[model samples]
Target: MNETLSLFGLATTPLELLSFVLSVVTVWLNIRQNHWAWLFAILSSGLYGGVFFDAKLYGDMGLQLVFITVSVWGWYQWLHGDDTHERLPVTQLTARGRAVAALAWLGAFAVLAWFLRSFTDTDVPYADGFLTAGSLVGQVLLSRKRLENWHVWIAVDVLYVGLYLHKGLLLTAVLYAMFVVMAAIGLRAWRRSMGQHGQASATMVLK
Candidate 1:
């Protein structure tokens, strides 16, 4: 599966190509608020773990394992995380929640970067750690149906493009570039969903 082939004039493997397709589908379903996205997320993350390992990106390889675990929790959350055990609704974080998330990202970055730098021979430990931390924040926010998850994804995906290119993963770099655009679309879509949820809540109160 790792055998190299030319696609779009760039060298890539079947494993990476498969992961790319699954990841795209995963994000598209996520934008639509479909629970099945988590299933695809798990598959893509597992595949990408092998791909990243081959590239010697230990941080990202480790992150793919985390993603697999989180995807399972995220699947359950999407199905029954809301009050009364219904599907979760789109919602924004409170001010304090946002502050906490930001702090968590920074703190995770510190620990991950230090560990990667000291323990791993990977050349881009800092970048890997930083992006890995950001992705974890985004994934948690997404699992809870938070509206700001798209914002975090936008930032992380943008940086991921450059990182993948530096690692000579041309197809994955293009995938992240596409993710940036899809994340913007997701932001707009979720904002509309949040507005609808708010209206529904107000109606229930009025009733």
Candidate 2:
């Protein structure tokens, strides 16, 4: 299924086209806060792993494996990760939590960049490593229903567009561009969800 075809004047393989479609669906479900998103995330990540491997983007290829593993944990977290074992609600990270997340992203980027540069023949090790690290952080936050996950996604997706284009993966670049807009919509939607949850809690307390 790796046959190349001209999709909207851009050459892409069947594998990439399939991956793009599944990824879009995955993000759409994520915006809706549907648990089913994790399944699609797993599927798309598996497919994209192969796509990135062919492109020699070793960091991204490795990231797909990570994504597959995380998706399973994320799926369970969405279903039963709350303190009370309830369905998780959209929430923002505290200032300290945010600081820790930032540190984690930076540390992961440093280590991944060094590893990719030292061990892979990929041409854009730094960009690949940086975006890969940010994606991991974003995925973790998203798994926990954190509102700020969209912010990480927005930043990473924008950079990924350029990275994919440079690697001649035109279709994947378009996918990342679309992800930027979808991530913005997800941010707004999740914020509204958090506000509604807050109002509901306040009502219960007042009653």
Candidate 3:
């Protein structure tokens, strides 16, 4: 632990500090249902993408590229994808959607695990695969305004905290810890927004 702390240097560097600040803002914006959240997501992902590459977390590095693309898609979806001419509302996933998501997660886990084991010198292939798959699902769900995305993030972030710590990425471990708390807050806030939307819809129907 002492050695790890020395490596990250207590987050004193400008890039480290900036990444932390951007992550906080990204979580806040996500809670608020703000489209600008994608912008911050992109920025945070780009910074951490480089960090992951430097650490030789190639799966995570590739995931960041996917995140950048998803951020762009999410930005567009939040702005104009809804039929009501409003930002996409927070909503639960359909049963079919959940089933599909599960299948996707399984498939991704298999593929990523095999790829990591064969192509890289990673020590924890299964853990990397699990987190990578979960993160992909969470990101996709988030892009579509699915409230369960936060739940996925909460789970993934908890695992990520330990993973980063094991990998000697103390700063990233700290960030994942923050992510867990922020995901809980985001879940509550988004649920509240969804409830508000439900009430509004009911009122409109009665009118």
Model 3 compared with the native: what TM-score?
0.91
Q: By TM-score, how accurate is candidate 2?
A: 0.99
Q: Write the per-residue lDDT of candidate 3 for residues 1-207, one digit (tens) a residue.
A: 111224345533455556667988998898888889999999988887777766678888889899999999989999987897677888899999999988998899999999999999888888988899999999999998999899899999999999988876767788889989999999999999999999999999999
| lDDT (10s digit) by residue, model 1, range 55-167 | 98998999999999999999999999988899899999999999999999999999999999999999998999999999999999999999999999999999999999999
Which pairs clash in the backbone of model 2?
none
Would you list the C-alpha lDDT of every candidate in the order shown? Answer: 0.96, 0.97, 0.85
On a 0 to 100 scale, what is the lDDT of residue 115 in model 3? 96
Misplaced by over 4 Å in model 2 are none
**TM per model?**
0.98, 0.99, 0.91
Question: Which residue pairs in model 1 clash with each other?
Answer: none
Residue 165 in model 3: lDDT: 87
Off by over 4 Å in 1: none
Q: List CA RMSD, all candidates.
A: 0.7, 0.6, 3.1
Candidate 3: residue 10 Cα off by (Å)? 3.3
The number of residue pairs in model 1 that clash at the backbone is 0
Looking at candidate 3, the ten consecutive residues that score lowest on lDDT are 1-10
